[model samples]
Target: MLPLLPLPHLNREFDYLVPAEFDEAAAVGVRVRVRFAGRLVDGFIVGRVAASDHPGKLGYLERVVSAERVLTPEIVDLVAAVAHRYAGTRADVLRLAVPPRHAKVEAEPVVDPPKIAAPEVDLDAWASYTHGAAFLDAVAAGRNPRAAWQVLPGEDWPARIAELAGTCAASGRSALVVVPDQRDLDRVAAACEAVNGTDSVVALSAGLGPAKRYRRWLSALRREVSIVVGTRSAVFAPVRNLGLIVLWDDGDDGYAEPRSPYPHAREIALLRAHGIGCSAVLAGHARTAEAEALVDAGWAHDLLAPRAVVRERQPHVVALADSDHALARDPGARAARLPAIAFDAARNALKNGLGVLVQVPRGGYVPSLACGKCRNPARCRRCNGPLALPSAPGADGAGTPTCRWCGIADANHRCTVCGSRTLRAVVIGAHRTAEELGRAFPGVPVHTSGGATVLDSVASGASLVISTVGAEPSTPGGYGAALLLDGWALLGRADLRAAEETLRRWMTAGALVRAGADGGRVVVVAESEIPTVQALVRWDPVGHARAQLDERIEVGFPPAVHVAAVDGSSAAIAALVEEAALPDGVEILGPVDLPEGQRHPAGGGSGRDDGFDGDVQRLLLRVSRGSGAALARALADAQAVRSARKNTESVRVQVDPIRIG
Candidate 1:
C-alpha cells in the first residue's frame, strides 16, 4: 500500500493485510483506509503479494474507500518519475495529479460517450511551415514526430491545434492539449468543439469550481472524451492511448505551478510524451531558451515558416532609435512618452477607421514616483515601499501619494533627499496613458484594459485602447497599428528571462495587428541598439532564442547545466548541504539573504518561522547535465534524513528553478 504521507522518509510503500470481507473490492489501484501509526489514513493499493517482505506481522486495512479503481498503473509510474525528477515525495505529486473524490459524481449512472465523425484533417493550415504537413501526416499515421513550432503572425493557432487533435482522434487515439490560461483554454476548446462536437471535447480548469471540474475530469478518466484541453493542471489527465501532447506558449509564467514540488507544464508534457512514445508539439509565437535547447540536442525538429511568408505576415516594426535623424527631427522624442512617430502612427490608423492598441509595461496610475527636484525615488515612511499616485485624484485637483506595498496615504509628504514636496512620475501606467491619449486625440474614444478590468475583445473601430503587457484586448479584424511604449521597464528587469519574456509579450501584442502589406505598423520606444529591440524590429525570435541559448551555455546557466536552489534559514541550509552526498564537481553559489517579500524561484515563500527565528538565505547548487539525476537523488536522500531526525527547521529544494536571479 502506498500511504498518503507527505513525510520524506515514508515515501515508500508499506505491506498491508486484506480482510476476507473486502477481498473482492480491495483491488489494485483502488483507494483504501488503513491504520498507520495508530491513526487511520488514506492510501492506495499499489500491488498484491502472497509473501510479506517485512519481518513483522502486517495489520489489516481498516476499510476500502471505494470499489472504483481510480489510479492506473501508467499514472503510478508517471507520478514516481515526476517525484524523483523534482526531488519531492510521491504523495505531493499525487495530490496534484488526482482531484478530491466526489462521491455523488462517481455514483451517478454511467452513460455512453457521444458518437461523432472525426473532422477531416486540413493540410492547408500546416502548409505554411516547412515540415508542418509532414508532422501532421506522421501523427495521422501513428508515428511520433516531436517538433518545436514557431507559429506565424496572425495565424489561427487554435484551429491548427484542433486540427492536430482531430488527426489524432481520427487515428483512434487520444490527444491532450495544455494551454497557459482560461482564455487560451476557451479558444482551443471552442476550436476543438468546432472540429468535432461540443460533447466530444472536455474542458478542464480550476476556475470551473470543484464539482464541475471534477465532472469534466471524470469524463476524461472514463475515456468518454478523446480530446482534452485545459490549463497547467490538466497535464496529468488520465487519457487512454495518448497519441499527442501539445503545449501552447510554454514560456508563460502561468504554466509554472506555484506550490510545493513546483513543476512546469512543458516539462511534464515532455515527460509524458516520452514515456508514452507519442508525438509532442511546443507551439508559440516566440521561442523559449529551453525549447531551443531541445532543438540543439536533436531531440526535436524545428517547424518554422519561410522567411518570405514570415515577412509578409508580420507588421512593419520600427524602433525610435532606428535612425539618429528621426530622433534629431524631434529632440523631445527621447523623453516624451508619446513621441511624434507614435502620434503619426495612431493618426494614420485612426484616419483609416481602424482601432489602435497601446501596450504599457505597468498597470496602475503612477506605478513609480520620484522627487521632482532631486530626481530621487519616493518611498513610504512606514514600510519603505515605493510610493505612487492612486488612479483618481483627490478633491483638491491634486493626487495624494500612496504606498503601493502597504497602501498607506501620505498627503503632506516631503522629499527626503531635497526637502521638496513636488513629485514626478518615473513610470507611467495604463490608466495615466489612457488619460493622456484621450487628451492628445480629442473625441477619439479611449479605453483602458488592465488590472481588475481586463477586456477580452474590443470593437474594431476608430478608437484608442491602452493595455498593460498580457492584458491587450483583441479586435475583430485586428488592430490597425500598435504602440509598444516604455521598453526599458520590461527590458530592465533583474531576472534572467527579462529579454526573452519581453520579446514574447511584444510579439503577442504585435501579432494582433494587421499585416504590413495591409498597412499595419508597430512602433517600439526603446534603444535601437538593444538586442531585444532589434530582434523585435527584425521579427527574428528564433535567432534571438538561439543566441540567448548560446550565451547561457557559455555562462553555465540553465538549459545547459542543471541548477537547484535551496532556501531556508542559515542553519537548515547548512545542514542540508552537509548531509547530502552530492555528486562530484558540483558547484555551490551564494547563501545570500533574500530580500523582503522575495519568493524562491520554485514558488517557495519566506522561510517558516517555526521555532527558529533567523534570516532566510538561498544557496544554489549546480551540476553537469549528466549529473542532474544524481543531484536530485542526493537532495531527496538528504531531505529524508532530515525527516527521519524530525528536524523542525523548514528547507525548500527546487531543481531547475523557473527563475535564477
Candidate 2:
C-alpha cells in the first residue's frame, strides 16, 4: 500500500493485510483507509503479494474509501518517476496527480464516451513549418515523434494544436495538452471540441471549484474523454493509450508549480511522453533554452518555418537604440518614455481604425520609486524595503509612499543618499501608462489590462490597450501596432532567464499585431545591440534559444548542468550537505543569507517554515548532467535522514528552480 504521507522517511510503500470482507473491493489502484502508526490514514493499493517481506506482522486495512479505482497503474509509475527526478516524496507528487475524492462524483455512473467522427486533418496549417505535416502524420500512424515547434507569428496556434489532437484521436489514442493559463486552456479546449467533438475533450483547471474539477477529472479517468487540455496540474491526468503530450509556451512562469517538489509542467510532459512511448510537442512563439537543449541532444527535432515565411508573418520590429540616427530623429528618444517613433506608430494605427497595444513591464500605478534629486532608490525606514505608490496621487497632487515588502507607509521619508525628500517613478506601470496615453492621444479610448482587472479580448477598433506582461488582451482582427515600453525593467532583473523571459513576453504581445507586410509594427524601448532585442527584431527565437543554451553550457547553468537550491537555517543547510553523499564534481555555491524579504519568520521545524530565528540561508548545489539522478537521490536520502532524526529545522530543496540569482 502507498500511504498518503508526505514525510520523507515514510515515502516508500508499506505492507498491509486485506480483510476478507473487503477483499473484492480492495483491488489494486483503489483507495483504502489503512491503520498506520496508530492512526487511520488514506492510501492506495499498488500491488498484491502473497508473502510479506517485513519481519513484523502487518495490520489490516481499516476500510475501503471507495470501490472505484482512482489511481491507475500507469499513473503510479509516472508519479514515482516524477518523485525520483525531483528529489521529492511520491506522496507529494501524488497530491498534485490525484484530485481530492468527491464521494458524490465517485458514486455517479460513468458516462459512455460519444461516438464522434474525427475531423479532417488540415495539412495546410502544418505546411508552414518544415516536417510539421510529417509530425502530425506520425501521430496519426501511431508512432512517437518528438519535436520542438517554433510557431509562426500569425498562426492560429490553438487550431493547429487541435488538429494534432484530432489526428491522434483518429488513430484511436488519447492526447494530453497542457497550457500555462486559463485563457490558453479555453482557446485550446474550444478548438479541440470544434475538431474532436465536445464529448471527446475535457478542459481542466484549478479555477473550476472542487466538484466541477473532480467531475472533469473523473471523465478523463474513465476514458470518456480522449483529449485533456488543462493548466499545469493536468500534466498528471490519467488518459488511456496516451499518444501525444503537448506543452505550449514552456518558458512561461505559470508552468512552474510553487508548492513542494516544484515540478515544471514541461518536464512532467516530457517524462510522461518518455514513459508512455508517446509523441511530444513543445510549441511556442518563443523557444526556451530547455527545449533547445532537447533539440541539441538529438532527442527532438526542430519544427520551424523558413526565414522568408517568418519575415512575412512577423511585425516590423524596431528598437530605439538601433541607431544614433534614431536619436537624431528624436533628440530625447533615449530619455522619453514614449518617443516620436512610438507616437507615429500609434497615430498611424489609430488613423487606420486599428487597435493599439502598449505592453508595460510592471502592473501597478508606480511599482518602484527613487529620490528625484540623487536618483537613489527609495526605501522604507521601518523595514528598509522598497517603496512604491500603488495608486494615483491625492487631490493635492501628493501620494503616500508605502513599503512594497512590508505594508508600512512612510509619510516622513528622506533619501539616505543626498538627503532628498522628493520622489520620482523609477518604473511606471500599466495603470499609469494608460492614464498618460489617454492624455497623449486625446479622445482615443484607453484601457488597462492587468492586476485584478484583466481583459481577455478587446474590440479591433481604434483604441489603446495598456497591459502588463502576460496580461495583454487579444483583439478580433489583431492589433495594428505594439509598443513594448520600459525595456530595462524586464531586461535588468537579477535573474538568469531575464533575457529569455523578456523575449517570450515581447513575442507573445507582438504576435497579436497584424503581419508586417500588411503594415504591422513593433517598437521596443531597448538597446538594439542587445541579443534579445535583436532576436525579436530579426524574428529569430530559435537562434536566440540556441544561443542561450550555449551560454548556459559555458556558464554551467541549468539545461547544461543540474542545480538544486537548498534554503533553510544555516545549521540545517550545513547538516544536509554533510549528511548527503554528494556525487563527485558537485560544486557548492553558497550558504549565504537570503534576501530580507525572502527570509522566513522564526521557526523550528522541517516544514515550510523551517529556519533559525527568522533567518534563512540558501545554498546552490551543482552537478554534471550525467550526475543529476545521483544528486537527486543523495538529496532525497539526506532529507530522509533529517526526517528520521526528527530534525526540527526544515529545509527546502528545489531541483532546477525557475530562477537562481
TM for every model, in the order presented, reads 0.97, 0.97
TM-score of candidate 1 relative to the true fold: 0.97
**On a 0 to 100 scale, what is the lDDT of residue 472 in model 1?**
85
lDDT per residue as tens, model 2, 128-199: 888887887788889999999999997889999998988888889889999999889999999999888898
Task: For candidate 1, write residues 199-230 as lDDT tens digits.
Answer: 77999998987888888898888888889999
RMSD of 2: 2.3
Instruction: Indicate the residue-level lDDT of 637 in model 1.
Output: 97
Point out where model 2 deviates above 4 Å: 396-398, 597-613
Best by lDDT: 2
Q: Candidate 1: list runs displaced more than 4 Å.
A: 396-398, 600-614
